[model samples]
Target: MTGEPGGAATDAMQFWDERYVSRRTEHGRIWSGDVNSTVEQQLKGLPPGSALELGSGEGADALWLAAQGWNVTALDISSVALAVGAAEATKEGLSDRIEWVQTDLATWRPSAQYDLVMSAFLHSPVEFPREAVLRRAVSAVAPGGSLLIVGHGGFPPMSEHAHGTDFPSFPSPDDVLASLHLPSGWAVETNALIERTAKWRDEQDVVLVDTVLRVRRDE
Candidate 1:
């Protein structure tokens, strides 16, 4: 029952459930638009089809994808966050385009293939079987489709400084891909390191580094 951002074996879903209960509708650092731009760029030009959005928080990206005509299934362990996300979808009249699921990614099993599989800012708290997970996700993508994985890069300002004394450090793109151990037929369409800086209310720059990777499953 581990949650979206894989961490420990003890109900990952519960971990996020608690976090979301406290924050309600507020977006976490992982929800920044600047970070999502890189993800949008990677998804550009994809046709409307079935999509699975992993760790979907607040439905920001999922709602946008549905607006683009994609049939999106957004999965998250946090009921509170998903509730707010559902409300947003309703507000945007996208409720019909999305199927919200409350599930833990650590134990989630793919029942069918999809045109696109997306995982954004899914930073695991501890070492995980990433390669196995990515490979499984890729396997879930139909041939001639794609898999996109985006997350906070390992190296950045304050990246090593730790978050509030209890947050887990982010993972690098290489670590993710390495965990996947992609097959030979799949080609990496785009791979880039994105550096994003945000101006806080205190005039301090909060640097966020994220990695974007796009892989096309061979037809």
Candidate 2:
């Protein structure tokens, strides 16, 4: 992945790198070791094929996709995070099933289309053109393929982590859908906010809202 030399772009990269490094040092893993619930629920019963995952932190979703028979290309901006995920994949005997790529999505271009493109919780604190990236992701979808994007709708009422950060505004389902500007033959399979219970600090179950958008390119 490549981008402009300076300004917010550089800051974004450094911010993510530091964040991942800290996570690796403190927690050993940043995200849950399981595939994202939105991904699992959306992909269930669908035929597996080529998949590209953006911001594939810790490779949980990618590993799960590979285990289900989809060849996966997992891309992330953080090498520290990728290394941790790579090690986990190797331990699970899934090393050959995934290609771990270190890339900045701000400028990374897809060389080929995929049957599925997924981005879960791809929020960033730095300045980034997320909509442009999402447009590129949609362009990389082959006909009859699908794109799934899930993001935090808002912080849970009981949250502590997101209390003091300048978290970017979470996009609504309509906001994400409108950004795609999909042409004819494309279908909006899912566009809504869904709530799920999550374990927070192993103390209590917290209800979190997810803004989910799934679109399919018609055959």
Candidate 3:
């Protein structure tokens, strides 16, 4: 559920919980149980370490990372989503490798630093303090660690989104970099726009532009 739309202007927990719970009765899962393409492309083959994911929908990325020997903290607003991830983790015997945390990112702060901090497609249809939350994650990155943020640059073809007031016009990679306000010790690693095919409404395939940014703090 990296980029899925679940609006919650007042109660994010209830809205997202219902979104996952109701949908699970129809579709087994909202998203494919696989690592995000951006995460796989950017982090594959790197040494396993502590990782934190801000919007860990059903824990696909978390499971994938744990399978690769990385300890992961998967956080989400909905307890239902976390339960799904935890169930899958136990079934796969990866429960010990991952910790599921249910909390709203707006008020929750990381108590410990991670070697990798991820905020993959942390978007919502409702108004959110996204930049402020991202700023909170900056100080949680350990020395020599990296922060990776991926976002939707545009909607898939033939999809409902029109980049209008209705849909969220996701930020660009440059906007993310500017918002971070990292100090001099940080170095930009990869900041580029990538094109990839994505599923629209779980059926149609369309190409989409992805905003990708990865920055590392000096050791």
Candidate RMSDs in order: 4.2, 2.6, 4.0
Candidate 3: tens digits of C-alpha lDDT, residues 99-126:
9987778776779999999988898765
Candidate numbers, best lDDT first, in rank order: 2, 3, 1
TM-score of decoy 2: 0.90
**Model 2 clashing residue pairs (backbone):** none
TM-score of each: 0.81, 0.90, 0.91
Would you list the C-alpha lDDT of every candidate in the order shown? Answer: 0.74, 0.85, 0.85
Using TM-score as the yardstick, the better of models 2 and 3 is 3
lDDT of 2 by residue, 91-120 (tens): 999888889987788887889999999999
Candidate 3's clash total is: 0
| Runs off by more than 4 Å, candidate 2 | 1-10, 25-27, 160-168
Give me the runs in candidate 1 sitting further than 4 Å from their true place.
1-10, 24-35, 126-129, 155-171, 199-205
Candidate 1 colliding pairs:
2-12, 3-12, 3-13, 131-179, 131-180
How should the candidates be ordered by TM-score, best one leading?
3, 2, 1
